[model samples]
Target: MQIDLQNSTLSSASLQKSQEARKILESRSGSGHDFLGWLQLPEEQSARVQEYLKIAADLQKLDAVVMVGIGGSYLGFKCLYESLKPAVGTPAGPEILFAGHSLDGDYHRQLLEYLEDRDFGVVVISKSGTTTEPAIAFRLLWSLLEKKHGKDAAKRVCAITDGKKGTLRQSADDLGFHSAIIADDVGGRFSVLSPVGLIPAAIAGIDIYSLLQGAMEMCDHLRNDKSDENPAVQYSAYRNGLYEEGRKIEILVYYQHAFQYLAEWWKQLFGESEGKDGRGIFPASAGFTTDLHSLGQWIQDSERTIFQTILDVEDAKSPVLQNQKNDGDGLNYLAGKTVHDVNRVALQATRQAHADGGVPSLRMKIPTIEEFQMGRLFYFFEYACGVSAYALGVNPFDQPGVEAYKKSMFKMLGKPGHA
Candidate 1:
């Protein structure tokens, strides 16, 4: 992915700050340095990624696969799955489904009933193995699997959790289910390059090798390149610079619909990583034309505290030419233009309009919507997130504030000690 900072409101001072920040990161002296396991994940966990491919092959015979996870556990997989699915709509393998991301009883119930007569398997992911949503979803789904397949359920079930501990690990061992380890140093939000994400991507028929290759290449580039040339450093600096200049909210705009989940994953990554000490910029996302009608008004005129980071796909896979029409719609000028051309024009117009309205903008031009590009994009944001949080004088890895809501909910539900 190529990043364009020309439209951003960053000055030379911000670039200097980013250079210093890059030094701090490389020296491993910044906050939350111990959690840098994700920095080299693509290379370090290559063997495990291969194992995920083998498991995915075995699961291909099933009708569907349910991945039980929440938050970071599933967001990356969701993005990967949607980004790389079969372009023809006919998947070569089992359909992958997600559960445990929400607490809605009816949703889980319907999912359970939907799988009653189908051949399905389960892959449960959790660090503690007792996170409320996944744990509950696992219990319901496990019972159904065992009832449907009896002793054969053990062959279909797998667990990706704490390597040496966690309720899920113990359960997996006791029930004789296949298991993968989530290392102690790798935090949930950063586990996309780990088995937590690779396993699901593999099952969904994504190209894990290409994905890792892209990420590994990006890692090397970010590590060796100068701050001025490194996209991650440049992005962190610009974002922090805007934040300091009263741009409180950063809107990530995607012209492609497939990137909706990518935006969701990005929200969690930045939100959980930097939202401490009340000093981080609020991360928001929107799909062009869809959200332009809804949120565009506010972004254009409501406040000057908003900035935009647009994700542009440089080469579209499919192109459609506008049909010539003499009707009074005044669209004849677009007769020879492709849909992609129109979208590009819309993006440019939006950038110009927002910039003229005093909203600073940045753009990330991706080569295409493929696994390699997606992997690079993920690492780019991950590296930038770490730097941005440290630059804000906060811990980039921990999410202490997230527990407050869980505590309240657990107490209200009278869940043991929380009550």
Candidate 2:
């Protein structure tokens, strides 16, 4: 992946700030540094490939597998699974469904009903098994598994949770469910490259090895190349520089529908990491042409506090549009342009128009959307997020603000410890 910051600004100070942030990150001396396990995840997880592969292979025997988790657990794997799913048919492995990301009863009800007829398995992800959403989903799903497969249900369940202690770990031991460990240092938002994200991706038949290899390669690149040319450094510097200039919102724009969830994951990563200490750029996203009609007017003429980072996929695999020759609506000016051809032009046009309208933008181009490129993309943003948040003078690894809502919910629900 390549990042073009020509349309964006990067002051020397911000560039220096990025380099300093990198040093702090590399030295493991920054705030919340214990969570820097993500820095080594690609190499570390790559060594354990065979173990996850075996787990995936076992789960693949079922018709479907429900992945249960919220936040980082759900978003990272969900981003990869949705972006890489086969366009034309079922995955090479079992159908992978998701749960525990929300509290909608209707959705879980439908999910259970869907699984009732199919031979299914479960992979529940949580550090503490008592987290309200996934705990509820897991309880419901485990019950269904037990009802359908009886004592053998243990064979179909896998828990990825705290390594030493958690309600989930105890339950896994007691029930004899296949299990994996989430290292103590890795935070949920950064756990995508860890077993928390990879197990589900592996079960969905994604090339997790290639994904890790791509991430590892990117990691090495950023470590060796400390110059402004480094994509991660450049991205962090540019966005931080813009934030200083009153551009307080960063909108990640992509043309393909596949990147929609990726934008969501990016939001959680940056928002939760930096949106503290009364500072941080607001992260937003838009799917072009689709959202253009709805959000274009505002972005074009709204407050000048927003900038954009456009994700440009240079070679997205897409079908060519066939010509409609009847001319009833209009004459066919083009006969065989690919859909990507039209989308690329739209990207260029929108970028130019937005720039003309006073919105500075950055363009990040990847050759195509595939496992290897996606791995690189994930690591790129993650590494940059660390630098970006630290440069903003906040702890990038903790989400103390997130507990505010949970505290309220627990008290309202009359949970035992809340009062």
Candidate 3:
């Protein structure tokens, strides 16, 4: 992976700030430092790979597996599954479905109906098991599983939550379900490298070992290399520099459709980590060639308060040739070119055009969308988000503001203590 910042100019102060922030992160002395468990996960969790693989093998015997969670629990695994799944054919493992991310009645109703006939497993993720959405979804799904499979239902469910105690943990023990732990130091947004994300990805047939290896390598690199050359440091410095210059919004641009959920995961990571204390750059995402038609005009002509960071995949893997034809479709001006060639040109052209329109940008070149590179990508952003948020003088791990709505909702529902 390579980060090109030709269009982004970082000041010396910003660079120095990034260095300090890296120190703070490395020393584990920063605010919310208790949540720094993710820094060691790549190495620490490596030992559990075989265990997760064995569990995945069991789950794959089913027709499908439903992953139930919200926020970090849902996004990280979904991002990996969607981005790495085969583009055109069925996945090698069981089909993976998602729930507990929303409260839509129609969607859950249809999901239940769809699952009525298929043999499936459930992986419910929640540290507290009291997060309204997933709790409700899991209750309904578990009831259905019991009604459908009787005493065997417990064998088809896995619970990932606090190891020692939690509602989910107690349920897992009482029901004799397979279980995994969410360590005390890892927050939801940062729990991807843990079993929270890896288990589901493994169940879906992703290369979990390579993924962890990539993150491990990145972790080692960041620890040893503390210079400006470090991608995480440079990324943090550049974005923070832009933020200091009144660029209050950061747009993460990707040319491929598979990266949509990856962007969503990123948004939540940065938005929750940094968007506090009346600070933080608003995180936004756009897909190229697709959003160019709709949002391009605004990005081009509107206020220059947004900076872009583009995720550029250097290769499109399987290339499709634009076969030469003579149907007078623009006179076949260009023929025998691969579709990726056109996409590459579009990426370059858009970057140049946007830069010319006063949008300073940074480009992160990903070698390919394989598991190793994706692991590196995930760690890169996560580490950078930590440094960046610290530089912004905010806690990178806690999302205190997130409780406001939950409190209001619980009160409205007259949920005992809240009422």
Candidate 4:
């Protein structure tokens, strides 16, 4: 992966701040340092990753697997699936479905009804085990599984939760379910390289080893590279510089539709990590060409407070030719072109158009839509997010503001501890 900041307004001072941020992250001397578990995570969990692969291989024989979790628990796995599975032709893993991310009655009812006829397994993830959505969804789903499969249900259930504490851990022990631990030091959003994300990917037939390898390589490179050459440091510097220049919103733009969930994961990573102290670039996303007709106008001509970071795929998975005989659509001057060719031109045009409209932007060029590249992308963004938040002078690992909503939610729902 490569980051191009040709249009970025970052300055020397921004570079210095990024250098300091790097020191802080490398030394684990910054705020939220306790959650730095993700720094060397890929290398640390090598043996456990193999175990997850074995379990995933076993679960692959099932008809479907319902991964139940909300927020960080589910987003990373979903992002990996959305981005990789499409390139893999037929999905090699079980039909992976998600629940507990929402509380919509009809949604869960439909999920229940959908599972009634199919043989499925369950993987419930939560550090606390009592997060409203996942907790409720797990209870309902486990009941259905037990009713359908009887004593065999325990073999099909897996839990990734707090190691020795939490209601989920106790329940896993009581129910004899297979279990993995989410390290106390790893935050959910950053736990993608951990079992929380890897197990689901393995079950779905993603190559966890290659993914981790890519991340490990990137982690090492980013830690040692210079601010001028390191994509992570440059990315952090660019965003922080832009933020200082009155750019309060950063829109992550993608030319590929498959990257939608990737964007969602990114939103959570940067939003949760940096959005505090009345600061942060409000994270937003848009799929291009489609959004070109919808949000295109605003992004092109709206306020200048917005800057864009575009994820550009270097090559297309499959190419379609514009036939020379198709003159009905106007003389086919582009008859020899592939769809990807047209798309590349479209992207260049869009970038130029947006730049002329007063938008400063950066581009992250992905070599291909493969596991290794995806791994690299994940680490790149994560490392940059850490540095960017630090350069902004905020804790990059904690989401203190997130608890406010939970408090109100629990009180409204009449939870026993709310008062």
Candidate 5:
């Protein structure tokens, strides 16, 4: 959990504001031990989740697993898996697959073809009984599982849903699937701590408790760390100040694809929290030198309405380019410079470019990206989003828009038109 914040820029007064904001976010979170106060929950949420995790862990003994979820569901756990890599928790963690991302029939058919006899299982993550991607994929995958594990194979199914009710919960219950967990009092996007995220990582064999411990620790740090000396508070204050100054969109641009999930994690944290009533920065992500080819022109010269937070890492484990066999098209001038060097230049160069363009740019430099530090980063963003949203007078813990879409889709799909 040792994170290098040396390259992070913050001033003393900004630290003081973050402290005030932290207190405000803590108040909104209320007294739920594990679940942040976003939605209503049953008392059995924690109890149910633990049991389901064991089964998810059991499935890791298989050849592979398919996670049926999208958005926050895929984003958070996918992040944990990619960052943690082969070290995901249990001794039996299996190879993992993520499907249902697109509705393309050929893509789904391709996944099924590759996984036909692979001895894989599915973990459907939807807090409610319905969500188009995961829900449909769940039925499709469940049928596949039923063929593999048998009709009584429901015994092998695991879920993360409401403890009392919901389509997924009721289905798991009716099917006698004894191993699913419920995500209570929290919305899908914010359910990273709850089973919406945990089970997939558990199946991947990730150290989820460690992840939660990291989150809780950062929560305490942000809430209690108070001052410019405290990195979370300092940035929260600075970002909020910019928001007040009319920076309506928070652009989180990064230089690495590995860090792409970091943006996914941030988008939900910021969007779900701050997007309320009429205010909050629209949390968006783009790649460094890459997106610059696409979005940079606009961000630099267009109507500037963003405060860019660049996630810069000083060191990364990347393959170095060698000039041992340099074929020249004037490319020999760049011969000795490694690709990592190129990325390093891009990181610093982009910051300068944005700043010179009159955008209030900020950079968060991580010495490196590893699980322990990524754990630190995830917790940091989650707590900061919570603090920032509360300061902006919104609940940073739910996704109303997501549920609205599902309700409408369910009704339409339930009727004959699409049914």
Candidate 6:
């Protein structure tokens, strides 16, 4: 209910210094880049989105839309779509799907099963066209398409790949599929604004313009309006200060299972941005009350090696429970207690106790974890990550470290998993 940030962990001194960061933010507001890299639109960067929308209209006639990329591929678009659960005009219209991970056969069979009577469209994404999971999955699906729709089946597909040329690009061209190129300079994790993300979002009927507007506004807030009032500087100061205070392991705890995606999104943002050359918070996630079973022991009684950022929602929009009915056992104390209410109270109590004790909890209680909320979270984390990188003198946009595994994986004969 408060427009002001409700639960902040910043001390007075740290909050005060955020004013300097705000000044730096004001200078770069909308004055900086539109899109991140070289695949500029005919006019402005947003013009490309309009073009993608036209393409999406045709592609949406299909029943399901499958994307074939990983990391940023799945995190940004999947997080937004699943969180929003956006309304669609038709169940037969385009919906978001992924097919670029795991070697398991059941899911592959299930995908085929789902497409039994459905006319499917796909967007296969790979900047290099060489990411293993995506490549193998896309190839398998490409074969399926040929079986179903014939050699020109690529007409029903869209390929988001390298700009000038790549294996995917050439394949798409040869097969006559429409194409959207990933920008040269923007890395996959940071390519959400690029066609890498927008194309699938467009297909899914998401208000990507609104999503980008939120990003643009947050960018403006980070650059031109980031006073101590701004969340970006405030969160960064609190988090980095905690790191300086030896709270190195940050467990991002969320209660609602749906909001769990925020954990992965946060991990990639903080982990990729700050974890350079042996530095940064070790980002981890907990679906609270649930993780209280597994991670709670270590957090509560183990070595004092952790802190928490609990992502709480003001309310779960839908909650079902029985009234104060009389049963055999006298359960009066818990009779009227809805699980949602109990969960919130428990989380609040946990926050208070952690703060009262030596361990500090950064309670980022979101107003709601809906589309706009997710949009807000994405912007907040992105700007905060930028500030963290700026503070540490690293480029937030590039991810050389993330690419290291691909290099090593190509050298190996087969999949050697990651935990």
Top lDDT model: 3
Q: What's the C-alpha lDDT at position 397 in model 4? A: 87
In model 4, where do residues sit more than 4 Å from their true spots? 87-90
TM-score of model 1 relative to the true fold? 0.96
- Ten-residue region with minimum lDDT total, candidate 5: 38-47
* Total clashing pairs in model 1: 0
Ranking by lDDT: 3, 2, 4, 1, 6, 5
Residue-level lDDT tens digits of model 4 in 60-132: 8889999999889999999999987765566755788999999898999999999999989999999989998
lDDT of 3 by residue, 1-419 (tens): 88898887889999999999999999999999989999999999999999999888889999989999999999999999889987788877788998999999999999999999999999999999989999999999999999999999999999999999889999999999999999999999999999999999999889999999999999999888978998898999999999999999999999988999999999999999999999999999999989999999999989999999999998876555554555566724456667787898999999999999999999999989989988998898899999999999999999999999999999999999997
lDDT of 6 by residue, 1-419 (tens): 11223343576765555555444433443212332342122123465778889879988887777877778766777766666663434434566677885667788778867876777877888887877778888887887888898966888888888867888888877888889877765566666666776778778887777766656655555556535756677776777777767878888888887766667777887787677766778898888888888876667776665777777788665555555556557555665567888889889887666655556666676777654456556766766666655554445555568677766765575554632
For residues 1-419, write the lDDT of model 5, one tens digit per residue: 33233333454555556666676555544322244652222122334446646777677777887887877777888777766663334434576888766677887888888878788777777677566677777788888888877876675567666778788888888887644554454555665656667678777767665555555555556556554556666567767777766778888888877777768777877887677777778888898778988998988887767878877777766666656454655566666777878888887777777778877776777767664466567667766666666656666665556667656776776955444
lDDT (Cα, 0-100) at 282 in candidate 6: 89
lDDT of 6: 0.69
Residue 55's lDDT within candidate 4 is 75
lDDT per residue, candidate 1, 330-406, as tens digits? 77777777888899899999999988899888899998999898889888888888877777778888888989999
lDDT of each: 0.86, 0.92, 0.93, 0.89, 0.68, 0.69
Top TM-score: which candidate number? Answer: 3
Q: Can you list the residue pairs that collide in candidate 3?
A: none
Between candidates 1 and 3, the one scoring higher on TM-score is 3
- Cα lDDT, model 2, residue 102: 96
Model 2 vs. true fold: TM = 0.97
Off by over 4 Å in 2: 322-325, 329-331
